[model samples]
Target: MAGREEQLLAIRIAETLSRAAEAERHYVKIIEGSSSDELEDPNNDDLHDAEELLAHRTRTAFRECQMLAERLHMPDFAKDIRKKLKAYGSDAKLTSLTYSSTAGEQYCPALADAWGFYEPMAAVALGGAVTGLSVLETMLRNTAKIIEQAKTTPDRETQVRDAVFGILDSHSWTRAGKLRLQRALKHTNRT
Candidate 1:
């Protein structure tokens, strides 16, 4: 009969394998979605969390596998796996829509001026066609354009405030996102 320690190790391995399989399925779905019509719409609230979720799941699976490798007395292999996973996570994040859009937000005028070049990558990150612009890309591009246009006016701050309020009134952003934007606007106006 197997010892208690052996049984426990087997159980842990089984659980880790199960998790790895699930993560693989998730990754496959994301990849397939990129080429299929089933890709999520840009307005989906889930899109807001996809990048973090993907990275988290991938890291979790790799960590579990690394632990298993260490348990099997393969320290060097485990360390190598850790290094590779870290590098992959960083690379994936840089290409993600969430990262790209958030980075663009930091320089709205430059992003607006270069939007055409950015749109295709944004679409691909959303699991859509590389040739088409995702709705999220369109929205970000429009928002940047608004900021850029406001920059040309004498009363630029007021114009930006009005434009932001107008968007809040007219668009259909997720409630949480909209609320966050509203709070940011109010906070900035106060300072």
Candidate 2:
């Protein structure tokens, strides 16, 4: 029962997240399928385009989140988040996968530890982590910080968290039957 504004924001976030995930998957598949297994495209122009598009699209999530924060009246939070995300763009940190979300900063190397160009953190999750906090925990926390820092009236943190979690739980971010978690966790613990 979200308000229209929150509903719209959630839809926007979901779409942006979906687009980013698609781009990452396309790029990762190309990287993983390459004969050389190097970060290079291996004479594949499509792969190069996919790589460029991933960077562009991934960085764009920041803007969409920023805009949502503004609508939520958290200008300072949006600015801070954008500042941190600035380095992750295609123009910066070329040939690597990097992510900074709430709870901590995470890194995904281009020629990574067996994952190659793809970073698992960039699982392109629409929801938060299946195993832990939300995928955008750090970004959302950054948004919350604006309220704390600005000394805004009333407590909006609960609403923010609820809205975010609710949006994620709405199932727009997950593929059908992919929401199963306990089994995945058992397998992960074994490794």
| Cα-based TM-score, every candidate | 0.34, 0.45
- What tens digits encode model 2's per-residue C-alpha lDDT throughout 122-158? 2332233333344455535675564455455545545
lDDT of prediction 1: 0.48
Query: Over 4 Å off in model 1, which ranges?
Result: 1-10, 23-43, 47-51, 91-191
Runs off by more than 4 Å, candidate 2: 1-3, 37-43, 89-95, 98-191
Clashing pairs in 2: 101-138, 102-138, 128-134, 128-135
User: For model 1, what is the error of residue 148's alpha carbon versus the real structure, in angstroms, after optimal superposition?
Assistant: 80
Candidate 1, poorest ten consecutive residues by summed lDDT? 105-114
